[model samples]
Target: MNPETAKPATAAEHFFDRELSWLEFNDRVLQEALDARTPLVERLKFVAIFSSNLDEFFMVRISGLIERERAGAAGSAPAGMAPSQQLDAIRTHLARQTALQHRLFDGELRELMKQHGILLLDYAALDEPQRGALEAHFSGQVFPVLTPLSVDAGHPFPQMSNLSLNLAVIVEDPVNGLRKFARIKVPDTLPRFVALPQGPDQAGWTGVPLEQLIAGNLARLFPGMIVRGHHMFRITRDADFTVREDEAEDLMLAIEEEVGKRHLDGFVCRLEIERSMPAELRESLMEELEVSSRDVYEFDGLLNLRDLFYFLSLPLPELKDMPWTPVVPAPFQAAPDESGEPRATLFDAIKRGDVLVHHPYHSFAATVQEFITQAAHDPQVLAIKLTLYRTSGDSPIVRALIAAAAARKQVVALIELKARFDEENNIAWANRLEDAGAHVVYGVVGLKTHTKIALVVRKEEEALRRYVHVGTGNYNPKTANLYTDLGLLSCRDDLVADVGDLFNYLTGYSRQDAYRKLLVAPLTLRRRMYELITREMEHARSGAGGHIVAKMNALVDPEMIRHLYEASRAGVRIELVVRGICCLRPGVPGLSENIRVISVVGRYLEHSRIFRFKNGGADEYYIGSADWMTRNLDHRVEAVTPVEDAAAVHHLEQVLAFLLNDNRHAWDLQSDGRYLQRQPAEGEPERAAQALLMEGARLGEF
Candidate 1:
């Protein structure tokens, strides 16, 4: 009955469908919306996130499958499903998720929010005065930006932008008595919901859907034609194009051209239309978009519920979750003397020992950003090297890099131009860094340099010591407040040497095969991971209580899953806290009986990756940016540094324990790929991981 003794099953039987697992993850997000315990506005936020996440899923994942299916390359995925099979499953699951999204929004959250005085009035429900006011607002603000394109013999079907909401009108030529189709793209510059001015009887601010307002006054746009019927529809196009870096003369230009092309010419992946659209009109739209019934979603309410984010951020504090401000870790905070200004800086603290930062709980500004800023101004700091995958528009990290370069310090910034949707932003940063006298590398030839690491070389009294900041998330200060990530500010000699070599391999042609204190992907990480798992199995077989715990965004790598299964069979207790996609079929009798997987979705995104191994009481832990996915382990540059510092190891252990013990926001993955929501046992108190972390942050305990 042991996992080691159980016969090995086929790949298909052992793994869950990847696309379906992703849909299940999104469903978990939707479950947050269905929960009445969640705050009203926060529930709305989850709905918006669900919609946004699904849109991206289709754009990249579904579109890739469609392309493969078209090219006759419908190969089986790691989970043993062909592209066609996965597509069919995705269509069914996504349809259900979409339907549930609308039901939660229109049937529940909308009414609940209205009762809280945030009125979302439909055009049909508006009074004459309110209608007139909205019409005036539309005429002045929205009318000038509107451009209506006619589709007839004289005019071709207009090129539609990806994810743009538009009104498809069936206009009748009054003189000729012929019906035609025309499109009016809702201005992306305008808000999806416009707030109307408060009237004498209006209790709270009433808002009108922007599309509804435009639909009500359609006659004004097409002055001579009779407006027969109009319905809202949105197009989601394939935005997951890769720049042929090998064939490209300039990677930046290639990425930019691809980005622009996706706006106009990307293949349509989804066509979401209003359910009230006539059957004939819907058919015509599907034909024009070149998408069949499989890709069409007829929503009963809003087409793009992602616009609900606007209302989620409204100043309705009573209906929202309490605001959380990230606290400064005790190590990062300065210790003021009697004069109140005689404290040591972040650099001084790092010089003493390693400082571990748990973000959204610990302030990134006080640690990561401060580290870069101080390095830029310090005269002794000679050079800086960092890898930038994705960051904010007004990124303080980018600004600091520019300052460091301007100060005549040797600065190398490897900007990954293919960070999925952030190509343009990275391009802008690369240009800014180049203009500011920094050497910019557009990543490696084929792989994305995704390691979140920054190395600073300082000419100290002892020697030219290296200071490193390696993290599990982007260096962007904005996301640091929203994503739960871990970072270590260390000056450890071995760790520093590994980080320097990593930067060298990223920037130059020098490639080292192994690292001392860090496990790097595509070279040492995978082999080291196997060794770690094998060591755990050996320990368990030798009568030592073997324990393995890991937390990542996903766990889809087949080799790693197989290792975990083998370890499970060997009596090792394997615990995984994956936030998103997980293909491992845990809790399968005799196969994965020793393994347990849990997912935590809460206020802060669980973005950090942690790996722990109880190596016969010689405990080892690592934290970094690599997830247990093939792309991260074999196709991208990643770094995972050992937590040699006892305090940092304790912090990671606490985090893993909190995530595994969570009841309110955790979902357990089953052998059949279905997730069961974890609930508190009778008489057991409820515990939310994010809340516990927040409380710990307030107390400066984590």
Candidate 2:
């Protein structure tokens, strides 16, 4: 057992290892799989999510350890432990979790399948009738796609691609009668779950793994040979891409080409051949993958059950979550003109003053999409400038940009192609944007342009007015319908001026020195936030009302953490709604007792960053793209804008207060790292924050 996993008998390390912290988060996700309250289908989705998360960890984190070991840079993690120490810790934790996963998943899946009347057949479980049917289907469909390669003097081992599941088969020739190793790649083009032919189970619901069917038909695949043994396994390789800027003549093209090759990365992790398999076959697989025993995990039943995600769409309504769609906010639902229209035209609302939107609760399609789509074709709109980090693979936002460019409107785009996993999508979008005559710029060299800002230049009779849309999340409509984020559409002079300068910085050669209404990072975000919090502390010391309320994804930056502690000591009541990794030790004697930290993990991913400070008699409110983490505050180019509209500010506080009061889906953080799940105090129903708000948004229509 990992030291981190064990409950300390005494006062031990106050902090958990960062890697262990991540694993704890993963465990929380796995907990959702076993959560009886969750919809049955959603629970299965969580299992798939857990598998996907672990796969990425092996590709990035585990792969990094291997790279460090190869380069003799083993003492990499800052905790002072050697690189080997970290790797050993990782292996121990993974082994424990893997065992737990099998225990939880196999049992739950079996019970769920029984309840749903859907069975997944295994090779031996199938009768002669089923075998005959599978054979006919295999010959017609699966055989054409099958490619078998034998390991002899003729074949040097082929390069194994990342995330490919394959079989290690042992076959003996009838004539020569010498056993040889053969490899059969699982055809990804074919569906992982194969439906049976001419059965009630097939017509309604029931399936078998393609691997099981292939295993049963192994003799047919290898004619004039006897299949002694075969085992199913998978290899997860290092998919992290590294490209040298100096080598690329065109950075965009080079990045796209490199991204295409990322699938064929170095093998780093392996899910093992079954323990029931022959020792020689297992040994052969380990040799081929170049993995140690620690790197290989063995499961009792299935190899890649993550494919169960496909079964989630099995047309079992009772087994799935109640269908829910995003709600349009009350303000927008009310007729804008008091006459008739689909709410208000977004531009007119911004022209009226500022409009703030909270997504999933507020319809993203109505608010943000309308903002851009309106501007794209509006005759009064002169130019549009937007910063895109990551959008969905297919986005209406990109279509709006193209339309804006087609209208001969000057469209400037700052496309950040280095957005980790979304690099390829961004690269493709950039090329399309460039070809459309839109002024497209790859973001800053050192810092990622993470600021979600949109500038619209429009003619308003007397002069050209700049209306800016600043947000705490991406412009991706899909995420907007799932993530709790804030978007402010405003035409304030100071904010519009700052946005104009930002556009100049991104699209032109101008260097912006200072922003009047916004605090931007990689330049001025930290100092500005520090000054705001310090002012609140000063007011609290002077016997003025002082309070600090912030909502963010994580709170891990040391400098900011110390500042928060100082504020807590100065009699400033701080409420933090952090959804993930928090290193700050709250509720400590003489340290941070006034500081209250709670995390809300529910259906929607809490992604927005909001900061509210009570400055003497006046209140200061801000919404931005940056979190309190170091990477967001100091390293990335981010934006924080003031919520100047009185109505908008009122609305922001309305929701923030509700989230703070939330007990259900909220976990209170202790002085140590443990997150104590908040249960209902009395026999009252749970106050699930997201669900309550969603109901509010739904009922707000009244």
- Best lDDT goes to which candidate? 1
TM-scores of the candidates in the order shown: 0.98, 0.92
For residues 396-467, what per-residue lDDT tens digits would candidate 1 score against the true structure? 888998999999999999899999889889999999999999999976788988999999999979789889
Residue 358 local lDDT, model 2: 84
Kindly report which residue pairs in candidate 2 clash with one another: 74-83
Question: What C-alpha RMSD separates each model from the true structure?
Answer: 1.4, 4.5
Q: What is the RMSD of candidate 2?
A: 4.5
Task: Write one digit per residue (lDDT tens) for candidate 2, span 1-702.
Answer: 232233322222323355555676677667777678877777878777778888887888778777777678845322344556777888888788777777777777667775777777776888887778878888999988998888988997767677888888889988898999888988989989887764544445656889888888898789989998888878888777766666667888777877777677566565555667777777777787788877878777777657768877788878876666777655555464556555646666677778888898888888888788889989999999999998998889889999999999999889988787899889889889889999999766666799999999998787898889999999999999778999998888899999888777766676786999889986789999899888988888889967999999888676787787777777889999987777677887556778888887777789989899988768889999998888998778899999978877887787787788787677788876677777788888778878777787778621
> Model 2, residue 357: what's the lDDT?
86
Per-candidate Cα lDDT values, in order, are 0.89, 0.79
Candidate 2 error regions (>4 Å) = 1-15, 74-80, 197-204, 270-273, 334-344
Indicate which candidate wins on TM-score: 1
